[model samples]
Target: MDVADGVLVAGYRIVRRLGSGGMGTVYLAQHPRLPRWDALKVLDDRHDSDSEFHARFLREAELAARLQHPNLVAVHDRGEDHGRLWIAMQYIDGGDLAGLIRRGPQVLTVERAVRILGDAAAGLDEIHRAGLLHRDVKPANILLTTDADGSDRVLVTDFGVAHPIEDGVKQSGGVATTLAYAAPEQFGDGPVDHRADVYALGCTLYQMLTGSVPFPRTGAGSVMYAHLHEPPPRPSAANPQVPKDFDAVIATAMAKNPADRFASCGALAAAARAALTPTPRRRATRLSVAALVIILVAAAALVGVLSRTTPSQARPVRTPVSGSVDGSQWGAFAYIAQAFPDLLPGFPYGSGYEELSGCLPQDTKYNNVPLDTSLPIGTLFCLGNRDPVIDLEIVCNADRTPIQPGVALADFPEGDEAWSRPSGSGHLFWGHTTFTDTGSDLDGHTTGVLEIFFDRADRNFCRIQVVGTPTTGADLRAAWWPGAPL
Candidate 1:
């Protein structure tokens, strides 16, 4: 039965319908005696009539109500109104994780992504400690909002299908979890446990990092096949800005075997945190100070990577090199100038106008340029671009470290066509990337990106990526790489 606005169910006055899912419709309602509002969820007639559904709904209300954590949504009351069961929960004004992702992948930096995951993981672990498995874990069920103190508050909601951990009891039935994040055991007659939640958390983490489900497929069959047989897709492969260390983390979290997965969701979050922390920079004292090195080199058409907010306000934070080797001739910047004489040597200008440490600020509308990917690596080797809406930047190692080109290329995998050829002391790679770039003052709404990689593995290198680039594999030797030929 539909409850109109101003109608009272169990004494709580309904305001308006907030949203609806398969089981019920959630509404904003006035609390019976409190000076506040609550989210009122009423069961559908079909499910409310089922005795099994009645037990499960009661289980949801009871189990969730018993637990109290900052990250889990609180249940206040539940009762039957006109033969339909209903529940009142703390109303959250902010949106869910699915909404955050829809805003675009650019909004989810590594820091922001991990913070959200950490909150969700904490809530899941608490549930597990209370002897329950949140069988339904997905982006839509995760809520995101700001606390009254202006801090991020994430709430894990909708434990409608939570099942108790029954050891060694293998069961076969219809899948009760999201298909995209389902573990292999979930698709078979295997013993399912907390590790399944761990696997789903892995998928959720992937979505936060790359803004797409780990197994992005239109058909249920394809997603199921991927979960059951295929390997987990790397987050760094989807967004180059993501650190490569996360690849191994995602792999272990989404392992085909539940035993292979992390012991708990908290463990997975810890691994991800470790991945985000950069390894200590080499202690070699033979590198030049970047701040001292940067100056008006000359008016040149330079091309590279981009992350920008607004050109007028943002300035990149440059680190000054110290010690005797600050004047050293051996460096990534010097190597790029010698290798590509026509190509400009510089770094990236950060996005949405946020100041990035070590990133050289460049304007989006002007000839300003930012360097390579968000990876904390060597100096970027810029090519050519005059009035650029996008750019291509390749990194050159400061210590001349030998990064295996194939392994490095695997980090940026979802491309239309990826190929390589010999460049000065390295191999130059090119491909059509799958990174979807969006901005308000965009050139042409960013239909595609052309990625060019100058890999001097013995010297560690980077990809030259340009958003809003031409769709052409016709000429690799052409000046379509902004202005320079490969």
Candidate 2:
């Protein structure tokens, strides 16, 4: 019978077919009584008639239901109905990793691959801890969830073919796993363990990083034999950007002999984390040099300006300026609000106000109270090269702001020239030094400081205010850096 002919089973209304796998057909169904959606995997009655397959399938579902991990798909219910076996699971809106890889290679960045693999490994580790082995881990079984915020979440699914350690199945399998990802031992005469899952994870990771499987070949039998006898190719051979350590990890996991692999999936995950850690030394060195150059330039300019002024004139003075928001900065906000209406509502001038200032070379401190938590708002304060002196200072708040205390201005690579635009803002933060003439007489200017304010529900709908001293047309052109293009 066709899937559509099936009635609503146990309050679940099958809306459409999700996909068909080796075990059964999965349907996207919703609960009639509760606000819930699920993927219903119904075993074909034909397969259930085979006692061996039915027993294995039911046992696999029971075993998987007992294993719980954030990355692993959660099973909600399992039972037999009208001669068909069915298992209900969480409905993952996003589909599997195979579709993601097929879209394009560039879509998968190194950082993304590392994160996905690390999360998947953590899931496998949990399964290993439960004394079960996911013998059929592959790209098709990994699901990717893309949230409204654009972040990606990975979910491992399809444990219907997994086996428990206590199950006394013989070395020669009744059911073999995906040929391309199956571990060498699956084809050998031995009982498989957690390492088998680790091997499959390695193959999946290899595919994610390189856009192709390590053992991709013509025939299924040929691929299965290669898993049994051939050494897996290094991922870096296909994508050199993959770190050598990652290649080593993959090689060790996919080793023909189980003794050569990591003892557990947890150990493999730790190694993946280490390989993915950003190179701190290189990033630190680059930031240090950039800070030094900025300090020297500011100091030289400060000295030249101080030379022209007397001591009386050089005495430090605080000046506060305010006006009816009518300037290029306001115009920039207006343009941004219009471009990203969803992110920045009530364009141009938002519900809050922002201010900017340039302090002379000296030590200064800012103590701000944490703005009310109920009101979601942000304020931007910028320090510009007013005196052209190499000055060391700290930007901090004793009780307010999300930025941590004791942040050195020069430590940030972009310096005061960097700005933070709210997530929903179509325009990125602009520093005082960046601007561009956008045809017409109008110019797009970057603010030295930006502040956003909004309520909790509208936190994403904050306003960006910029403050900076005007520069000559030529100087502005020289320093002009435009906001990120939409």
Candidate 3:
């Protein structure tokens, strides 16, 4: 029974068909007596003739309707039309999480990703407590919206494949799970429980952080084999911005053995929050600070083992410095500078650009450069065409202190500093350096400087100042430092 737009069903008028899939067709619907609209989903007609499928569909609707968590999508009404099952649910104006992720990994920061997944995990916990599991917990099943105060609202939708937890795992005749995010036990006729949801949530969080599924969808057979046998790579490996602790969290939640995973979805979410949380920096004696820097410098690219501690009692953990260049005194900035010419956007300026890379060794003998052991090593690169020359300086530190925007204007001729708050990429500390009589590659041109602090977890940072930059702050960030927010 195809319901057309403007058709009335059980006192609800169908505005338009929202979407359709193997499970059912969803439509924008309105209640005649109510003021607000609702999402009306009608189960496929083919299942109406099959009593078993019909019963299962009705059961799912009943179960979902009974669930009333803030994070879970609300079910407004359920009824039958021409022997077909249909449900009216709260209509969400904001698109699904899959769309947000498809935009880019930068759309969801580490903090935002954890909060979204944590909310879904809380909703999943509620479902699990009621003796049920969300069999499908992929990005497509997660809906997103913004609150009146501009805070993100995450809603878990689509309980079409929800299953009851019986004994340790629900008895299932066949697997009905998304292969890319399924647990090992979900592949075979093994007992599946809430742990399956934990595994799927882990996979979802991985995608949210790195914009790629745990296992590449090369082929169905390959994915299945990989899930069962291969250990998944850490998200931090793909996106260095991810904290090292997150690697352990993903590994634990997506363990091949269910028993090795977190105790529950709620526990999994809590672990994720802890893993991504940054350690608080405290004031220490100069000797202690020097020792800490020495330990971090010596550790070099090794993973930092983080322990969970409350904010009031938080302590510093030695974060491993991650970068391609190792121990040559020149930091990762020198390496990235070599690749900056190719990484820059190409249109009118790509064919005729000159690239020059150099670095000033940190000299305690020179008063211009600080002698403080806490200060990071720096590198400089110059790239341009005939005009609007771009000069970039990369700074790296083992410590995770926040970047200061004013620091970018230190070397240039003294000028009135105009600092702007961080924008699209939180790592950017951009501003303008006007009122200067500097004589360099840029002799007589207004200068706009941007300090881009790379991934804190990796301990990489850079200061990019474009002389005669003919673009907005947003454009400069998008073109030069794509991974600043990733």
RMSD of candidates 1 onward, in order: 19.8, 23.9, 19.5
- Candidate 2 per-residue lDDT, tens place, 1-486, comes to 236724686667888767655477778888667799888888854576698878877876788789777898898888777777778888899867765543323456667777777788888888878877778887778888987788778788888677776774346543367666788777766677888888888887777676566665433455667787787888767666667668777888788888899887667767776777746565456567778778779989999987888453665321111112222322322222232232221212111111011111111232232222112222322222111111112222222333321222111113222333454322222223333553311145332432223232223333333333332322221222222111
> Candidate 3's residue-wise lDDT over 56-159, tens digit each?
77777888888899999998878887676888888999877765554443456788998898898988998998898887787877889999999889899888
Off by over 4 Å in 3: 167-173, 278-486
lDDT of each: 0.62, 0.56, 0.62
Residue pairs clashing in model 3 are: none
List model 1 lDDT by residue over 244-268, tens digit each.
8999999999999888889999999
Least lDDT summed over 10 consecutive residues: which range in candidate 1? 349-358
Say which prediction, candidate 1 or candidate 2, comes out ahead on lDDT: 1
